[model samples]
Target: MKNTEQFIGKRVLVVGLAKSGMAAAGLLHRLGAEVIVNDARPLEGNEEAATLQALGIEVIGGGHPSDLLERGFDIIVKNPGIPYSNSLITQALERGLRIWTEVELAGLISEASIIAITGSNGKTTTTTLLYHMLNIGKKKPLIAGNIGTVACTVAEKAKNDEVMVLEASSFQLAGTENFKPHIAIFTNLYDAHLDYHGSTTEYLDAKLQVARNQTAEDFLIYNNDQEIVRSSVETMHAQKIPFSTEGKVVEGISADEEWIYWLGEPFISTKEIKLPGRHNLENILAATAAAILTGCKKTAIENVLSSFTGVRHRMQFVREFNGRTIYNDSKATNTLATKSAISSFKQPVILIAGGLERGHSFEELRPHMNNIRTVVAIGETAERFTEFAKSCGVEQSLLATTMEDAVKVAYESSSEDDVILLSPSCASWDQYPSFEIRGDQFIHAVMKL
Candidate 1:
């Protein structure tokens, strides 16, 4: 913990009653800060608000009041998912309220050294792998941030000897001010969350913030292959360590077809890893860099890399039924992700894709169409995906109303030794609450077969 006394008697507002907001409110309240929690969900059936109220924290349910910002709170701990376009956030910015994401709050109080990972993709896998590496090294590491548990909640109990591995997002980083991680990993960059950030420049700016507060004493391990990623931090003062799958790097981590090279020394072999895709290769490189810098042994890194299957919903193997290998990649909620997943397999793939249309085109994925044997389009963007698939020379492109139907169609059409992959190139909001649920349904449907 940095200084708990700084928050004593300070007025703070915690906005949005999701996991992050609730955790922030409780942490601040316990730290002697006067905390007020608010959410748009109505008072009825609001279990989150009820819990905060029980903690003696003031709770405002039903809606975000227009005058809530005028209450003279000294600080605002906002849920990153709450868009800048939201009225509450707009008002707070207008009133010059010091806004912080729970990550920022965590950084202020955490005695544990933080290792934050951020990118458009591969953040969860890299963060999880780093945590596993630290565990193998006998370091007590806390896994928090965008994956599940709030960073602040985890930091509340974090010990000085422990390490906090966080899966940071642009949303979270966008609200951050002085959130500096001891070791920061920027996996790779792609244009994403344009709907929320409104433009590529704004989105990149948020992602770059992970390195802003870092100094020469701190470390930043980033992708050397991504031009945009490399250019973003040209002027950064932090000790830069580059990880590349594209070519060998003299001072950092690099990967050849056979092995990963750490500072020109042979590290781990790629053949031992189970996760598919070149994107996963990039993830391994970034994780390996961070792990080595944090004192993890090569044996520990290899042990996890070989044994670790993969994170769920991100090219997770479902089952083999009727000679076809089924894979659930519902986390591929963008064209780039779908393209990478498709590129991973040499075997013909019966791809089940499409979801809520977020104004992104399927054009980028067109080049990988040759690898796709069949297409099963589902959700709001089904027609768009189907049409695009046909235009890209896919022999058979079918539309399904449900995930079950998509699975069945893919199974029936797929041949022996083929892969039936559920790599939806859009979000799950049109039919399911999240990509996890969409993936679960895909797994269940595969099990039934």
Candidate 2:
């Protein structure tokens, strides 16, 4: 941590006590900030709150006092999930008080060079792949951000010689002011998280923050196929390294049916990659470009690409049993992702789909159901998926109230050489706390069978 003096004698309020919030509060307190932690949940049984209180930091719980900001804090470090429309946050903005997410703190203190990846999709896969590539290439990389680890937590222990591979979400990036990465990757943008951001423009603006402060010394590996992403970075000072699966870019990276080329030279054979899906081709190109920029050897990148099957809960292949191959893609929480998952295979698929009802139509999914042999629908969107499946000429459509039941029905509906896939096209909040838990249940059910 190089900038410890910045927080000395600062009065900071840490809002919403999740892992990120807790980490921020503790770090701020250690830096000599007068820290106060607050959460809407009651703090009586909250162990995190108790831990902070034990450190002599003030803790407020149950609700936000209307006059909480009147306590005259110098800054607020808010959890990413907390909206700007939040009462305290809105008020803080109106008063011109500095507000940020903990990622800003990560940038301020960390001695490591950051490699940040952000997009509507493919952030996790690209981040994970780059980490593996750098690990094999001996880059001394540390993984952090929205891929489960908190950025500030990882940044605290990071060394100057190391590279921090971060999976940044729009929520996290939105609160960043001076959080610039040494090498940034913009995978691809689509309509997502409009509810929290209020519009597609606002959401895109937040995502673009990943490269906002980069100087000409930095490198930006972006998706040239996405006009929105391509045109948006036109004015950025970072040296742009474009990647595309749709067409060849002589100055950057591109892929054909045979090989992935870098700077107009063949880098690796396409057949060497084990990860499935054409959408992933874009991710592969992006990660490979970043890896090359980070000095990863071609052999190291090839070794990772040939062996990395997939990220867990994101087109992850489970074992083949009873002559049928199963895949868990519970991370497909929207139509676009589900389409990608479905289009990855040519074999007949017994697809388990459906989840939370967001009043969105399944019509967008209709054109991609050519290989869907049977549909096992579950959760709040079950009925709508079932109807959509029938309309697409699927022979069988079954409904289950739970993931386990859905797995059972899907297995029964499958045959030799068929693919049994769980790629729910909706969020998991209607049935489970997160998509990871829902995917775990699917894997467990597959094991039981």
Candidate 3:
């Protein structure tokens, strides 16, 4: 761990009182920094602010006062979700104050070996799988980052012998300067979060930061199949180990029609995997390669490959009612994700799609519409999805007023041999706060049938 004395008598400001913000404030205080927290949300009934105040940390709530920038804070720890476009962040940058995310702070203090995962999709699934794989191999893995647990909290509680598997996002990766992972895994990149990063180039640049600080001793397990992913890390300093679903990669992991191969040897059969989708097969291959690099037993890797069903909300199977299989892929917040979800099944799909538009179109989803028997549209993009579906040669499309109606319509439209899939090609911000809630509502509606 780095010296806490460097923080002693230093002035620090924590922006946004979310999970990462709270943990960072407490850590700074414990390290002897004079910490002040600024959150745009109102202070009344704000438990996080109250807790910080109780610890003698000054809390400014409701707004980010412009005068706060002149307070001579030595550093600012901003939550990753709070965009760089935020005024306070811009002001901090202009004033030349060192800005960081909690992940950067975690890297400084953590004694445990860190294995970080980042991508446009499959971050949570691959991170969870690797955590489980390490556990079965008795590696004592602790999971954190975008999957929910605060990194600073995990770093403080982590043991030296333990390994930390972090599910990092582009938001989290953008704020780091010196943060580096011992083992960094890049699951394929896609067109995502363009709203925040402003462009595809910036988004990919942020994702590459996961391997930024690694050395020759560290490992970078990545998907060579993704041209963007492969190109970004071409000159990386870490030992590169590639995973691919598109034929053989010398001295790396690859998969064919029926089997996953590792280092020129058959590792696991595709038939043993419970998770649906070729995309998930990609996720599994990435996780397996990382696990093998970390010395996880082949038996443990096979067990997870064969038995781990999947993470919730990402192509998760809900139920089988009357002969139709229902899948809740509410995490498919982009067209690429929805396309992958729809292409997973061999049977005809009754696709339930539509949600908040993130400047992404359903045009990419059109090519896969041949497998979609019908589409039940909902939320803000319903009409847009319907038009896209029709243009793609889909003969049947229905617009539902509610999620329950969408589920009902899908089930009613599906035959015994068909699949009812809830893979929204857009985000849930229009109706639900998160994809988890959207997925839960879908499951609830399916249960009532």
- lDDT (10s digit) by residue, model 2, range 1-449: 77989999999999999899999999999899999988999988999999999999999999888899998989899999999999989989999998899999999999999999999899999999999999999999999998867999898889999999999999999999999999999999998888899999999999989999999999999999989999999999999999989777899999999999999888799999999889999899999999999999999999999999889999998889999999999999989999999999999999999999998887788888989999999999899899989999999999998777888999888899999999999999998999999999999999999
lDDT of 3 by residue, 284-334 (tens): 988998888889998999888878877899888888899998898999888
Put the candidates in TM-score order, highest first: 2, 3, 1
lDDT of 1 at 364: 91
Candidate 3's TM-score: 0.95
Better model by lDDT, 1 or 2?
Answer: 2
- Global lDDT scores for all candidate models: 0.89, 0.93, 0.89
Measured on C-alpha atoms, candidate 2 has an lDDT of 0.93
Candidate 3's C-alpha runs over 4 A off are: 357-360
Can you tell me which runs of candidate 2 are displaced by over 4 Å?
none
Judging by lDDT against the true structure, name the best candidate.
2
TM-score of each: 0.94, 0.97, 0.95
